[model samples]
Target: MSGLGFETRQVHAGAIVDAEAGARVTPIYQSAGYVFDSFDDGVERFAGRSARRAYSRNDNPTNVVAARRIADLEGGVDGVLVASGQAAIAMALSALAQAGDHILTTDRLYEGTREMIRGALRRQGLEFEALPIDADEDAWVAAVRPSTRAIYAESIANPLGEVVDLALLGRVSARTGVPLVVDNTVATPYLCRPVEHGAAVVIHSTSKWLGGHGSVIGGAIVDGGGFDWTAAAARFPHLHEPRPHGAPSFAERFGAAAYSAYLRSVVVLEHGPTVPPSSTFLLLHGIETLSLRMERHVANAVAVADALQDHPAVARVHYPGRADGQAERVARLLPDGAGSIVSIDLAGGRDAARTFLDGLRLVSQMTHIGDVRTLAIHTGSTIHGKLDDAERAGLGITEGLVRISVGIELVDDIVADLEQALDAVLAAGERTATRRSAAAQLEAVHP
Candidate 1:
């Protein structure tokens, strides 16, 4: 399995062959707790001195399988499953930083992630500063303070398909001694493995593409297992500090997987944002065909983007792989494709977005992305609605921008729906202009 292809590994990695019942598929271990061999065994498990799991909250066989499977796909050492993508972000950050610590991040990210950073995490007393996506390595290094614990960014941003320079950020992480955390929900492990680019931690909202059927909600955090926690002792005292009696510190005990070990044993254990084994069961199934599904997703996206460009109402198409200066970055980072999000800025503004959304027949207008079905949303009004007009403008959230999560449907059908919607936007704009012209004439006659 170590040298297997991604397609093969997605199906086989972290899978358990039940020797007891000879089950082929991983069965759901639905019990609240695992029975121990004896009282001493329970103590061992509780004390983290045994290999057997004592409780289902932190360690369930089914959940472990999903976590390991995602970690394997991302080329990481260890992983943990959580209730949602937000939990993955929160848990990973909580493990790395505490109150009064600072975090550096790229300006472009999912609105949901941004909200968490601005709203909940900020309320917790952790400080955050966003750098421009195009910030150089030196700029990132300069931003790091003694309290800076992490450099966070999304692999491919939401609504607007901005692709961050992950390799550059990875280099920044190395130079600054801060771990790089990446949210790879949009790209998934099939499209991009952040660890290979130098990310110390990889995050995912498995509810999206990983659970391709849109039936389950889950998240995962993967440790790259490369950062030298011992070397960064001054910055990360917890990883280096020894335990109460004679116990070794996380870095001494887990070595490469120290961060993940601490996250699972402490942060996640205390917070208890555990995902159910049933969700993991569905997630595992979705991952089996991830490679296959992503290929079609990319293809449909490229086709849709091409179609949208020729429409009269489209002002711009925000696909990552376009010739828009980032062509090289997209080619280097995302050779397979620049993911399935193809956002179009309408020339007719917010009114046009409303009309276009109203005219959609095949594509579902909703909040979620990376689903098997094509999903569309006006981010300025939904995801970024909390932000005022100025804030939305700063993030390039135009009034008419509509994000399309291209699915594996027939290219023609998807294109047809989009084209018809665009045509309606143009027709609505024309009617409005005509009414305005008639009103102007009436005003002049009255004067």
Candidate 2:
């Protein structure tokens, strides 16, 4: 499996064959608890002396196969599957930083993540600071305080599609002695593997591109097993300290797998955002065709972006593959493709957005992304609606911004649908101007 290709690994990497039934596909082990052979067997499993399923909350065979497959795809040592992408982020961050600790992140992140960091995490005593997405390396390093325990960013930012400078951030991580944690939800493992650059942990909303379709909602945390948690003992005392019964610390017992072990055993298990076997089964099926779907996704996205750039109603297009100053990064980091998401800012503002959205014939207007069918959403009124005006502007989410999750549909059909919608927006704008001119003339006559 180590020397195999991506497509091959997708189908065969973590598959477990059923001995009695000879089942080729991974069976859904939906049992709440695995039966023990004897009393000693149960004690050994409970005491951590043996490796076997004790409870579904901690681990399940079906979920384990899915986690292993994702870990292999992302080039990680191990992975943990949770209920949703938010759980993955929470578990990974909580495992590394405690109350009163600080986290450094880029400004352009998923709106849900922003809400979690500012609302839930802050109320729980964690502190967070945001640096400009295009900030200089020196500035990023300067932002690191003694309490800063982790550096976080999205591999490809949502809505805006900003590509992270991984090499520069990797250097900052090295200089600051803090692990870099990246949310790779937008750019899946097939497009960009952050661990290959220098990320210690990779997070994914399995509901997105990884799932290909919008059918399942899940998340995963992948540990690269590269960060030295013990070396930074003072900064990460939990990993360095002994267990409740005076057992060896996580770092001593698990070595490179310390963070992952802690995340699974303590954070995920205690918090109870565990992914069920059924969802894991769906996720595994999605991974098998990831490569195929991604190829079509990238092709359709590039075509749609090219068409949108020339539309009369579009003020600006924000696709990385088409943007200036992003070519070099795209060529280096995302040679396969930039991604399938394209966002366009309308020239006529909110009214134009409503007209375009309402007139669309083929593209479905929705709140989700990374589906087989094209999906559209007005970011300002939806995802980023909860943010203040200033915060939304800082993130480049304007009143007229519309995000398109280009699907694996026919390119011609997608373009035709978008063009028709844009045409409707133009006609609506002309009607408004005509009405305003008539009102002015009436006012002059009355005066």
Q: What C-alpha lDDT values do all the predictions have? A: 0.91, 0.90
Instruction: Compose the digit string of candidate 1's lDDT tens values, residues 229-302.
Output: 88888888999888667688889999999999999999999999989898889999999999999999999999
Model 2, span 1-447: residue lDDT tens: 699999999999878998889999999998888999999999877766678767889688898888889999999989999999999999899998988999999988999999999899999899999998889899999999999989999989998899989878888888888999999988899999998888999999999888878988999999987777877788889988888766788898999989888898888889989888988888898999999999999999999999999898999999995665888998999999988999999999989999999999999999988899999999999898887899888788899999999999899999999999999999999999999999999999997
| TM match of model 1 to true structure | 0.98
Candidate RMSDs in Å, in order, are 1.1, 1.2
Residue 312, candidate 2: C-alpha displacement in angstroms: 0.6
After the best TM-score superposition of candidate 2, give how far the Cα of residue 253 lies from its true spot, in angstroms: 1.8
Q: Give the C-alpha lDDT of model 2.
A: 0.90
